[model samples]
Target: MDNHPTTFPPAEEDPAYLVFLDSLDYLPSDDVARIKAAYAYAAKAHAHQKRMSGEPYITHPLAVAGAIVEWQMDADAVCAALLHDVMEDAGACKHELAEKFGKPVAELVDGLSKLDKMEFASYQEAQAENFRKMLMAMARDLRVVLIKLADRHHNVQTMSAMRPDKRRRIAYETLEIYAPIALRLGLNKLYRELQDISFRLIYPHRAEVLAKALRAARGNRKELLTRILENIRGKLEHAGLRAEVFGREKSLYSIFRKMQEKRLSFSQVLDIYGFRVVVENVPTCYLALGALHALYKPVPGKFKDYVAIPKANGYQSLHTTLIGPYGTPVEVQIRTREMHNVAQEGVAAHWLYKDGNESSAELQIKTHKWLQSLLEMQTSDSAEFFENVKIDLFPDEVYVFTPKGKIMAMPRGATVVDFAYAVHTDVGNHCSSARINHELAPLRTELRNGDLVEIITAQNAQPNPVWLSYVKTGRARSKIRHHLRTMQNEESARLGERMLRQELLSLGVVPISIPAAAWDSLVKASGQKSLDEVYTDIGLGKRLPSVVARRLLAREDMAGDAGSNMTLAIHGTEGMAIQLAHCCQPIPGDPIIGSIKKGSGLVIHTHDCPVIRKSRSTDPQKWIDVEWEPEEGKLFDIRIRVEVKNTRGVLAQVAAAIAEAGSNIEHVAMDADPERLMTSLRFTIQVAHRTHLAAVMRGLRHIPEVARIHRERGGEA
Candidate 1:
């Protein structure tokens, strides 16, 4: 790969290459020369390599560039496609490519290559990371993804030589990721082509069966379809609407998917006859629609006016299902010539208009907005990012109206929360409820096609954990999770700082007085990149705060293990770190001892807790003494077992008494006991502290049906 070609033919000398160059009639003389130069460089770089098919590797890049050209992409995209693999497969570098071609071409090529200077845990993670980088580049310049898609399209076409397992994996990735992305971008033709090929590779038998079935069906319906087509053409011509009507068959992959998704037989899915009507302008599209409806009754509820409200991908058409001759279902899509261009080419149709097209320009804006939003996601895990992106690739969508009458498109099952987030992240974070169609509704209410929604927000409101259960859009789910995590990390960092400062004080070290060199030593010795990271480890209980604090000082300043530690105080507000042990809930005023749980900060237990006694014998060092100075306006949970006489109103009476005592029940459970004619009820109630707990129990003692009551305790070590 390091050896460049010593001898090569001129670009025009090759007859096939000359034919390809001639197709660049739209490109300027300078751009055509640059494309030719890019090919020459790529050919030399890949001279020593051969594809799995035993063909020269240059043929791969040539085919990719040809696809880019067929997409009507500019000269830079064509050049980038030609050189996309050089930096990855050969010894060529980005700097070298940029110096030879230009920065745009180099960046596009870089976007197509896998990430460098990083290590991934697995192939999926590597693929996800590479995908994220490509999206970022594509947002800035749409041509980046175009080159990648083209490259992938060609790869799938030549995947026959790959191993079965590898071929299956590639096919799944194409359908799961690439095909959906293409559809979302409005590349209908490429999208269908990709599915067809990948479907064949993954399930040759199934594809062949579907293809044969479709051929047989078409042969059976040819005469009837031609007569129906003729009648429709005659009707449109008489109505004075100029329309280019043609019949279209659903792709085999589409039919297979419909069969699987809806659990229908092949014949059931194949009966939906498809046709397209391309007119001269927008008015003619509607006129043609009216003419068709007059000729045959339309299938009610199947009419979708995409022209009035376009899809998120800027797809516009008048779609309706009609009961044609013989009562057969005919699906018709009506669009203008310009709309047809966007529908067929998707984002690549931006080049179709010498100036600019509405839907085409709209596609670019929406794509940029969607891609830029990923920066706010800031998910560190590659697999998670990939998973989140899959939601945004949905082809099915619902369009709703904001209070201001502005339209917003969301995924099919997206709820009020999704709309809130789509409007603004802050709105979603603070949203308390919503009013759907002027009626108050739950935040999880699924939006409809034209439902007007008004989001109600509260300043103190934050995302509830339950919101994750119903959120349908990637943006809302990610924003909610990201905000929750950011808040938790911030709280953890602050708690860690307090713990570190306390430990340092016990070690006779004042953090403000410590020299910068000592802090550096702490970071370096702890294998942590910064002081915050060291504190985070301590905060998360991965490392003992005492141990980490001692590392700050040099050996001479290190205090012996005999040093007394300051009693760590529990505020009950430390998020995940420094959590109260659930085995024996120890509230304020309860005698407590702390145990270090790795990956979770100190867990406080009652001093006489049996769990502590059992574990301390084996790991005495894990035990630490702690005290509670629980935060104000916070609640602590304590479980109590009540033995009540079996009666209809006994449960309700017991609950009323607890409420009277100003305590809230967090959970309820029932356990078996030896008591006769009595129901054992376990209630996990939240109170302010030990005094509050006494009040709840004292209130429960007044219930007439209550036979006995006692606070649950961790009995015996």
Candidate 2:
């Protein structure tokens, strides 16, 4: 039914596999024996299973392991890759693998197992948890991730066997997570291939169109490639430099993204063909760059020297784009043989360490420090591990020069604060300012690759809360929030304790009698911690004073008429000289009454005070009618208002006179005025009694700038 060639043998066929093994230079040895053992075990375990494509189940694992072998990985990784799916798919157990092989191999196999038995409420939750566990496994050992990537690569490559909708979902996840990780680890070739495969699956129709267009244009670009290669090779030869020039065509995914993002047609995409110039040394890399520029006009901002400033993933290459034959844009890359090995193999080069003879220990460690960071940040649960993994391994990077001209690569949009944190946590904690390109800017300022950043720190300063909004690295953000949250919790607990202790003391209760056992239970019942926690809750508005008092009273066996307890005595006459509750303003001339509320003690109010009217019907026993006694020199703070001409010194003069008249100003506000050049000011003041209030009002009346002054009479219900 398909139009493509039917003769293309399936990957699992003996002929195809022979070619794969030959390409890897696989030979008969102990390692080969171990691989054979794993293959036999996997073949038996998956004997009854069949793929959606009607292939035997062992074919999938073989394909996955085949991808690993393409990277020329170690024998253990290849064996682990072959058996990775056995535990998850079949009834195979870890003990069997351990007995057959060793614990390390068994552990590797177990780490790759997916959570298949548990039922999740939603596919999203299951996916998240599964990904989380996979990342944790990768943190424990990088080989797990390498094998997983290989598995994903093979699955994507053979996605035609899957339903269209399933293919799209898997493709999206690959683009969002897998491809970025590949690039983050400096596996550029693998990264591009995975992206292209996913793209073909997710958008088959569009992919076909692009493919056809690329095919049609291939002939047009052929001569351009030959000419450019010839020109570059000729120059290197003339310069007495040993160089190998090869044409590098852009992948389908790269072409598709460029066309879409730049809104260009296939023919408009001129930078599709590039050349990679492999040299013998770093000095020759620069020399080749000069030769290429002299042959063609170099694009101003298209040149990047990653060799001098290697990427975070240890990618070292000199890159540049120039106007080539017939005005076509062509990209050129230059690197040494060592750089090429690191570029192609990435962390897989670490396997040379196990081979027992590595030339540079420091270089190997330097190349893998980022991998170690991923392992370090992997300290969280599976879900968090993947979340942090995606962040820490993001491939999009910005290269910046240090104050000493040393280059450092960080995530794109990484700010000065991120740089500071990257330098050291202590430096980040105390960072106060930064100068990018020698110009003072905010600490959250995004840093450019070549920009020289000067970090300014102070011992007394700590990270600002605002930095969370701009920091790009997960480590910096996590550390900043962790520090701030800890500080806030401690401060809040301290304040809460102080407030609780004060309220308890007012009751003539020495809280010392409360046993630790009883206190812990009471605190839990109150939804808090120690006494300080109770107070902190009070200060934070989580708990009210009256609520705690009521709960404490119930626990203390003190139900003495609620309000008429010894701590708070109601009127002796049961009616005269009632005290007004300052919570709501109540003037002396206003009709007032008293109420006995639980825990809050005696709460007096104006006769028509809204509080009494609202609670009057709920509990009559608690509301006791009382009368205010005249001539009781009880000072009450009340809010009043005064108007004066808008002037700068008017506030100072008013405050001075109030102080001079023996009245305390509790609160004040000046409202804006446009006409009459007058401003209205509200003042809450404390006076000895109504007579003192009148005296205070009379003193304010003599000020010539005062237009009017009046007490805000109590409200009527």
Candidate 3:
């Protein structure tokens, strides 16, 4: 899929290369020559190209490589960053690069390349497919994403010369996709920068207005902020605590988001300025927190110990709000020096602190786990996969506990089903309900921090389609959807196999009697990868069974309708592939016929149902004889028209009769003829089979207010 550009640009020296050479101290002395070679290669490959800023193309890579250098990446990452765009935009191939540099560097560059060779239906489709490739490669080597973030950072900072619409579109993507990805990886510095620049580009007017307001507010609060910072530093020193206390201002974009989320004016959004106390060790972090609290009265219910249970992105700090000397609010975060580095740099801190830093290692592990989850959520549709990734890129998180007291950090609004999937996919699939803090709760219950959750699962339980509506985490939704899709495909395959077998029987043949070579030939001829694909196509009505039957049998057998008498058996649990007609509401005991409906697969109708009877004669091959397997403990919905005396308590009485007869009224509608003194109540009730319907009808007839009752089975074709 890699489209190697054939026209290589001629090499020419540029001043930007000299500046980039100075930032390579992070690379080993032996690998420095290789990095320079990569730079020269990319420089020549893009010698004639220029950015919208009119800078030589190689400077873009230099800036991206500079950012990764700030994160302290290795030699290969440096080389890969230098040549990241060469394979996509310049004349280069992965094999040549791999032979020249190394496979690792070449693969990194390959991962960063866009899928420009493919045609997509929309811009979103193209972006999603490219991201899908990049994400998959990221799961293999995390440096790919690091280089990508650095690349995105540079692009976002240099997009002023682009058209307004393109600028807004890229800004939207940077904010929605890349910014969250940065935060998800714990790259706080890059995340905030990307969000702020994107917010400016997307809403220029709002950004400038907010910037002006912030400038005014900053001047007014300058003296107060200095005083507070000095007070915290003095107290920490007085308490024998070694700490670096600094004032931190919220980013303009973060302020804007807070205003929008909370619906507040700029003046109403307080706590824009905060403080951070970086200490020598973990114990000193708490000591500094205590010292800061001693300096000012702590605000009530305004403390969070993220260090105890880190956020989903592996962010850890002791955050607290205090009443300052002037009676205004001051927010402070306490953390160790290593925690601060990891907080700002995120996964890149792994390589920075590769010398056995426990906090950095933990963050690396958590990030890899999240990346693996993203990889596991493989969907056929690239856009859908992108959506699932967005779902996982949650900004807020809540920490909860399992029944065994183990902590699990989930998205803020995640429900019990999300928690279950977070535990394991099988657990989510089999989850029936949950116990929250020793009390029974529904599956859709939104979890709270510190609540002990115990998933109640059943062996035979399956994921309900309704779970997709409320489950917050993409892991749960994707797992449930994957299971349901597999189930439907399997059901369709089974039904298609049966249909094919029945057709074969009419031609005096059995499926097993067909040779393996014959089936393989048929599969190949049908242009399907395997026999299951052929069957799935036939079962879904995308391919006609009669046509397939003719292909599998001799020409002499096609002269008669011998196999037309064969009936296909229907299982009650043929989910998604088999639809019971809404008009007839056929139960297990009802005489049923199957109609192949385009897009819907197959619909089962009662034998005498008016909806399919006309279609049955007009299109004879569309209808097939089907018999029910009569599954136990399965409920079927049936509609009944009940004529009742026009009375106040008559509706309640009819409902009670249905309930007494062991049926549930799913829905009820009334049609009143006031002058005739009679009312028609249409009730949709669930029953086990036709006999259960008979019992409900008999119970309703026994009611004194009931004049007539009969099953309702009328619909248009």
Best by lDDT: 3
lDDT of 3 by residue, 207-304 (tens): 99999988998898888889888888899989998888898878999899889999988876754458999898888888888888888889898999
Worst 10 residues of 2 by lDDT: 568-577
Superior by lDDT: candidate 1 or candidate 3 = 3
- lDDT, model 2: 0.72
lDDT of 2 at 98: 80
Instruction: State the TM-score for model 3.
Output: 0.90
Candidate 1 worst ten-residue window by lDDT: 1-10
| Predictions in order: lDDT | 0.83, 0.72, 0.86
Model 1 residue runs over 4 Å out of place are 1-8, 11-13, 116-118, 505-514, 554-565, 608-613, 666-676, 713-717
lDDT of 2 by residue, 261-353 (tens): 999877777555688989988898998888888888998999888876677677789999888776778888898876776677666655532
lDDT of 1: 0.83
Q: How do the candidates rank by lDDT, highest first?
A: 3, 1, 2
Clashing pairs in 2: 132-382, 399-449, 400-449, 496-535, 496-536, 497-532, 591-607, 592-607
Clashing residue pairs in candidate 3 (N, C-alpha, C atoms within 3 angstroms): 506-563
Steric clash pairs (candidate 1) = none
